[model samples]
Target: MRKTVRVAAIQAEPKWLRLSEGVEQVVELIGAAAASGARLVAFPETFLPGYPWWRWVDSNQWNVEYSTRCRENSMTRDGLEMRRITGAARDHGVHVVLGFGERQDRRIYMAQAVIDENGEIVSVRRKAGLNPIERKVFASGTPNLPAVRHGVIGRVGALSGQENQRPLLTRALRADEEQIHIAAWPGNPEGEAAGPDSAATVSRMYALEANAYVVAPCAVVGAAAWDRRGPQTGRGSGQARIYAAGGAEVVTPLAAGAEGILYADLEIGSAASDRREVELAARPRMRRGQQQAARTATPRRLGADRWAVPLMLGSGPGGLAAC
Candidate 1:
């Protein structure tokens, strides 16, 4: 594996339910990242069709309206929209880790896809754990899916927002010997995850525990985008940041939200060395029974299998938490 590799994380407003437009925007970002010399590029969770900020809002009407549109705009794994993205990766000569709503049959899962520079759609992992409200919109997939794999830069992997908090999921990723892990999030407050200084703590720990560099890109909710004008920065919105193995802070292009790409040159040798020291031992700790228990208990935990995501109406947007 190469000792150094360049990566990029995108922090921008989503295309918002425009499937073809979303593909174009992704292609643009890929080209820009490749031009900037990034070997790997990552985006925030559900970035293509946009994050369901409405689900976090209390307005059932908006949630109902938006959820349907989001599903309709969601891309299928084998669809032309995805092919365009893969083609962009191939043309740009960069590995892409992207988050999108994956339409499969009648269900939509919060999904992440890893595409290699050769245009091969290598892995598509769905979100396995959903919070109560998230269950209202997206379907949970099988947990602890394979995330680590050989790619352009080296062994790479990706995960959606809350999955970073899931012990089993992260453990599985670590056991897989991931070198660069994309910690994708829809968007969260800066000072979160144990309430340190910034949300970096969440990813910092993830980097340390997984023995990998962390590329955490977050989504931004544009105030005008609510009305479909353009993406304007909001207060305390997310940043595109990266952390080195063992929690060393790297470059961050946008620290306080807006539109930009975060880039970092990582020394992957440390992660490779760490994995060599731990992967075997960690694999033994991952019990098949543990996954079985979670799967068996999921139905009760997520409530009756509602085919459509419910919009648990509340007082207002201010009443519910977005991200």
Candidate 2:
């Protein structure tokens, strides 16, 4: 018998208040996905009670009380609201992987959890690393990727946001030989204006490289927070998408310009076939060898002025003079 599954991407914002409020939204999404005949539903990064944009670009005028309130409102494994989310999944007989503003020992981590069909929290993955700006606010996760094999299908893991840019982390996840890959993204109102689209593109590339199915659940900025910007000042909403092995589209884009759900059916085993046909390992072999060679290469001496000439001549956005 061929193995197949249906997945849904929840491309909407968190409730932006307390855990109960967020859970209500999550339940609604999960119910919708299940009603649509989806077995697995993926949500965007920090879709639980909203993302922590205040730390990075929310500006120097951030309301400390509000940030603290949001953090306090975050969910934990032992929290009641988490149980609600898990219970909802169980009741609906769906697997859910969702992003949450996770609080541990007073530190916030951009985190996600994988709940099984039985409504059990199977695995949790924290964002292993943060970008330069994100460092100001969120905590870095431990260096590990967790995947679980349930029945005939394989459940593997990864993260979203800036972590998508990290080759090392994704490469490690790929090394684990996951069949289904998840990449969470935040929606940009400007239509892929921010790097979310690029991140999704990168996830597809990773799926192609790793010979795994990629399910990207992107988040949309809420109507009230639509115009909000980080310190860098960018627009946002979230979106959800799924990519098959070899960068194939499993479903059409669900929520393109606004809040909605996107879903697709996945044919398993396809990734494995692609894996053998392309000899996926070979793609990384040359790069790994180059790194090994670089470590053994003799050093070359150059003056500080040598670097200056290239910058002076380089043609790019921030050119020599722009620098």
Error of 2 at 238 (Å): 5.0
Write candidate 2's Cα lDDT for 1-323 as tens digits.
34778888777756664678788989989999999998888888888877654554445556465567767887787688888899999999988888887888887777889888899888787776676655555677765634444533555665677666565556556555677877887665344644444766777776777777888887665444423433322224434667777687777776454567887778776666566656655533334444445345543324321111121223333323211
Ten-residue region with minimum lDDT total, candidate 1:
304-313
**Alpha-carbon shift of residue 120 in model 1 (angstroms):** 0.8
Off by over 4 Å in 2: 55-58, 148-152, 189-191, 194-197, 226-238, 277-323
**Tens-digit per-residue lDDT, 240-304, candidate 1:** 67987778788745756567888888876565775686655554342455444433432212323
Best by TM-score: 1
lDDT of each: 0.76, 0.68
After aligning candidate 1 to the native by TM-score, how far in Å is the CA of 103 from where it should be? 1.2
The segments of candidate 1 whose C-alpha lies over 4 angstroms from its true place after superposition are 189-198, 228-235, 274-323
**Against the hidden reference, what TM-scores do the models get?**
0.80, 0.76
